[model samples]
Target chain A: MRRFLKLVAIEWKLTNREFITIFFTLIFPILMLLLFGTMYGNEASEFMGGYGSVDVSTPGYINMIIAVTGIMSLPLTLAQYRERKILKRFMATPTKPIEILLSQFIVNILLTILGLVLLIVVGKIVFDLHFFGNFFEAIFTFFIILLSIFSIGLLIAGVSKNAKMATAIAYIVYFPMLFLSGATMPLQMMPQSIVNISKALPMTYGVTLFKGIWLGDHLIDYPLEIIILFSITLVFGGLAVKFFKWE
Target chain B: MNVIEVKNLIKKYKNFTAVDHISLEVEEGCIFGMLGPNGAGKTTTIECIIGLKNRDGGEVNVLGIDPNVDYKKLYNLIGVQLQETSYQDKIKVYEICELFTSMYENPVDYHILLDRFGLHDKAKSYLSQLSGGQRQKIAIILALISNPKLVFLDELTTGLDPKSRREMWDYIKELKNEGRTVFMTTHYMEEAAYLCDKICIINDGKIIALDTVDGVIDLADIDQVISFETEEDIVQLIEKEIKGINKIEKENKKLKIYSKREDLLTDLVIFLKEKSIKYRKIDINRPGLEDAFIKLTEKTRKVE
Candidate 1:
């Protein structure tokens, strides 16, 4: 237990040392909230379909945090550790390798929650954002989206041959979803062809489902989104476990 | 008592036999060196004994424990530094020490270890700021921090400077003085001769020789080469007339005499004097661990 605590602390420190993770998770989402909130004035705007600009993108920004930790930081760190044989070195110790893995999950998941809370706080303070859905329902749906995206990151980490390849693949998957899934941009303003493209992306469903719940719609009304997110979680999570490599 | 015992151990990577039915035993409180060429399966055998790799056949016992089945407990007693392993680049030197020491059952104070390695002042420096030699030194220090009853080091001084290498040799000797069994593999012959009480040489996934430094040299049976600069071409004369000579090699006026006979040098002078062949700059080269290692790993069949 002492060993695990030390590993978690070390992993946490190491994660903090990464500038990109910090920017994407903590700084960039706030930038987005402030950027969009200033332009649209946080009023019930027709541009966002009766939701305030900050109100809508605020939840979407939580998905953005999920993308940063789940798709970018988590997979990249695992790949770098494996490529460098850091995992093998730790394995030779009395510490179980699983503890190292579990600590990463714990740290990334906690960071996602922290980022989500920060976004919500900024939205509430700066824009007086309205929350109409049940608070518990919002928390529950946030986790489902978090898991599905994180599992994709795990799958990416498992299949990549090296850290460099992992980065390239992660960029390919993440950048498109970042811009197209309405995580960063309002999908209502996109060309009809781009909106059609978002239909095929998994994050679009996540954002669409999460936005609906954030706008006072119940989770049961979005069965397709719930089923799709759970399917992604089950399939990608299983494949990640099957193909995971320690070295 | 034997700290490590292996019987007919075998490990294969796909169809290629990596560790082919090899066996050796390491007694307590001695530095046992494994010497072999690249791709000779030395690392594979170490991995199997350390429980990092599974054996295809045969049994391995480390400190009376089956490594493959009970490694978590066994690891508390043994320290290992794998060759290709590395530290996290963003982690500080002190943090790495703390993290590694936390995993052991009874770890020594790593601060003292860092001071011993001359890394005390670099505690705050990230791994990216340190040199390769410094990181390698940390690996060695981390291995000892476990206060292990047994230590396994693969290529312990491959990237170290001369000072650090000598320091490591002295420290490893100190480990043996403390009654810790040390098992290591290195390509440096002098390092092995200076550090190892017993040595094992494997080639082609099989044990070729396991003996002491001089014993391995003797086992390879390499003849000493006696060289002399001769004014005349007496190669045929030395070959035909000299007694106790195994073979003769000549390049121009330089003649090299290879023989296992102890009296070949004396007999060669007498023969050359009888023939009145003027010779100067005569020298005899005795074979050491390197010649034996090369011959044993490259040319010999399995001898164990």
Candidate 2:
């Protein structure tokens, strides 16, 4: 436990020095919230599929923030560690390889929570955005979504040959989720075909669930989204653990 | 006591064997070297002994524990310095040191280790900010920080400049003086000659020769190199007259005679005097590890 905590602490210290990850995970989401908040004001504007801009889009952008944390931050760091044989170095010690993976999970989870808080605080202060419904449920739903997305990221991290390949994989998964999965734009505004495609995306389920909870939809109301999120988490998370490469 | 014992260790990758039934023992507190060319399975053997890779066949005992059975138990007793291990680029030296220190149940004072390796001043410097030699020093310090009874150093001085290499050699000797069992692998014959108490020459995934430093050199058969620059061309004359000339080569106006005979030096001088050959510089050079490695590997290659 001590070794695991120490690894988590070291991982945080190391990650804090990365400017790009900081920009995308923490700064970028807040910037998106501010941009949309300015353009669509506090009133329930029809610009966001009849929902107010700050009301629904801010939560969606917050989903994008967690997506960056999962898809980009997790895989890139793991791949870099593997590429540089940092994982192999730990294999020589008593510290098992799983400990490193767990530590990375802990560190990224903390960062995502911190980013979520900052996004909420910033939106409330500057844009008059309010969480109309259960805040605690939103946090719970965010964790489930994080688990699903991070498992997919871990799969990429496990299979990539190097850091460059991991980055390419991350971007390939990220851009689609960001633009089409209701993370950046509203799914209701899209054509039926794009909505159908969005329906197939895990991020779509994540955004819809978070948006529901932010606007006061109870957790028991969305059975399908909950099933999909938990299912993806179990499947990809298992594969990630089974196929994880230390070298 | 043997700190490490490997018997007929076989590591196969699909169809090819990386380590082919190789066996050796490293005695306690001795600097043992595994000397081989690339792809000779030196690294594979070390990895297996350290429990990083699994072996297909045979036994590996480190600190009286089978590494494959309980490598975690051996972790505190054995330390390994891999050829190209690295930390996160943004991590500071001291931070990495502390991280590794926390991994061990009982760690040596990293401050003293860092100062000894001349990295105390660079403790706050990030990994990317340090020079290659400094990074290598930190790697060594990290390996030793756990105070392991046995240490494995692979290609320890491969890319360093002469000064840094010499400094590393001195530090390795210091480790020996501190009573640590050191097992190292290197392609540099000079490094093996200077540091290794016993050398195992591996060729084509097998042990071709194992002996003390001088023993291996002596076993190479060509024991002495007699070279002289003659005003008169006597290459052909000496080749015809010298009874036990093992090999001979001529460059420009100088000639070298390599012989395994015990009295080749005396016999050569007598021949020179009798032939009235005016030799300017006559010197006898003892054969070293390089000559032995080439000869041993060549012999093994022929058998294969």
Best by TM-score: 2
Q: Cα deviation in Å at residue B257, candidate 2?
A: 2.7
lDDT, model 1, position A118: 84
How close is every model to the real structure, measured as TM-score? Answer: 0.95, 0.96
- Model 2: per-residue Cα lDDT at residue B149: 89
DockQ of each: 0.83, 0.86
Where does model 2 sit among the CAPRI classes? high
Predicted model with the maximum DockQ: 2
Q: How far is candidate 1 from the true structure (C-alpha RMSD, Å)?
A: 2.3
Error of 1 at B271 (Å): 5.7
Per-residue accuracy of model 1 over B1-304 as CA lDDT, tens digit each: 9999999999988889999899899999999999898899988899999998889999999998999999999988898989978888689988998888888888999999888878999999998888777888788888888889999999988878888788788888988998999999998899999999999998888888999999999999999999989779777767778777788888888888899987888888888788788889999999999999888776755443
Worst 10 residues of 1 chain B by lDDT: B295-304
